[model samples]
Target: MAARNWKKGSFTGLHGLESALGLFYTRHMFRLAHFSDIHLGPLPAISYRELASKRITGYINWQRNRRLNLDHGIIDRITDDMLAAAPHHIALTGDLVNLALREEIERARLWLESLGPGEKVSVVPGNHDAYVPGALARCRRAWADYMTGDDGRAPTGRTAFPYLRVRDRVALIGVSSARATAPFMASGHFSKAQAKRLGALLDRTAAGGLFRVVMIHHPPVRGATHAAKRLYGIGRFQKIIRKHGAELILHGHTHKPTVHRIEGQNGMSVPVVGVAAAGQALGSAKPPAHYNLFEIEGEPGAWQIRFSRRGITDPHGEIGEVSGALLSPGK
Candidate 1:
């Protein structure tokens, strides 16, 4: 990820403050656990037909490098830690599978079920999820329950992107950037049509005085990823944020922990955060497996957020908080 050029608010150890404030806001606090980029492995057997196109390159890459670096056991540990924290809701950004194989999709669905029910969790797809022309349709069919909005309809057909799910005082908005690309290319696309819908959703949610959180698989800011894996139409996405604003934005794709700020309404700078891959092993070249817990409280226009980054930081394979910060809204 590139260095952030805009001003960023400082992060503090707000856990102490949270302890003090808990007396009054315990019931109001919404704990949201976010993790992404599973790329679940032990890739199932593939027929010659399965490896006909993009799968061939992905298969070769996984067998050569990904299988060794990504450990399902580490993912299990992370999930255990996340569950122990007892977040009110869990948000998974994307890349739940590698090759988007039929078996991989099915296995990922089971993994999702283990986390919790559809009402307690939300998801968005990544480039790998839609690795081929038909892979995304398969994922939609298998994981529709997880991606459906609060209205109880699965995200299917044309009105898919920018689905809405309201939980308590927060409005969780999911947008898809997942799409199939040429071999050796790992890119995502956010259409203008999605942006138009997102703008409307943001407006409606904002009017309801709910804490709006936008979830996407790829980072929406510029220079966040390599050209080969960038999110096209990011400008349109940013335009939506600039106009209607959101309380926070969560994403995963660069496979690294990053914080960037996007200009929001009335000069408010919304926090755009990305977590390291949940399946990445400790001591790997990239940041180790990790998850983020966000503590949000307070009503509209007076929100307080505390962010804690937890992950395996040692050789013992134990997961702990790597960093903490007090995030001020509109900073």
Candidate 2:
């Protein structure tokens, strides 16, 4: 009996050591599929009653302007191609619906279900997701599962902002910048409370040696979008980053593909990336509908992000590789 117990203890110790070595010596690789600004169309028929508020302007704009610019079929094609690539996890930045109507919010929930389970996909909201006063509240309840962290803990009061989800070696931090704006405005904001919490989250996580990826709807940098749609408290975000730093930042709202770098701790250049509208047509003034596939390799602080930009070409309607690049953030 004594010999058997000794053998069991030895085996357990060896197993723990083996797991530690596996994490240190070998690079854990995974593909992250990112796409945003769906802006799903064929809006549910609005009632003359429903069109009384700010929704009226949005409805008219959708019917006259957006209908020609965006296409649901294009989104289908883009998603088909994205699924074929077989990503480990998917990150959907926001704007699933344009008007944030009850019908649209429910439809967006269905659309999220079609993408994959809530566990496999992480979503954040866009300005369009919270287009009206109560629309944001409606959206949060519907997408609560997708928006919350995987920590399995219930919130004390309001659902907290800047939640964290860990997958393997990656830590995906979700930030909410979506806010209801007045007519003709598309701005986004992050409150001081969220900013303070975010700094603590980043500092503690970065110290623990996990690759931190920030998922927010609005870009956290100046000149990234028009003044009307710009993300406020960008300075606050940058300050936090300069002190603690994140490995990557992903956002969507501009319906444009953009790549940028912001200051990071120890003088590293953190990559801030954005994708074009996932449901936008091929040649609608905006970039073609597309998705970003990031192939992450190596360990935290020494990681390499290889990105493949897949997109559709206008007039031809052919899906092809739009661009590819090797990203060494903080290098």
Question: Global lDDT of each model?
Answer: 0.90, 0.84
Candidate 2 segments whose C-alpha is farther than 4 A from its true place: 1-25, 153-159
Number of clashes recorded per candidate: 0, 0
RMSD of each: 7.7, 6.6
Candidate 1 achieves a global lDDT of: 0.90
Please give the distance, in angstroms, between residue 161's alpha carbon in candidate 2 and its true position after superposition.
Answer: 1.3
Per-residue lDDT tens digits for candidate 1, residues 227-258, read 99999998988988999999999999999999
Per-residue lDDT, model 1, residue 262, is: 93
Candidate with top lDDT is 1
What lDDT score is found at residue 32 in candidate 2?
A: 89
| lDDT (Cα, 0-100) at 218 in candidate 1 | 92
Predicted candidate 2 versus true structure: per-residue lDDT over 125-185, tens digit per residue:
8999989888887888888778878775422224467888887777888888998898888
How do the predictions measure up, each by TM-score? 0.91, 0.90
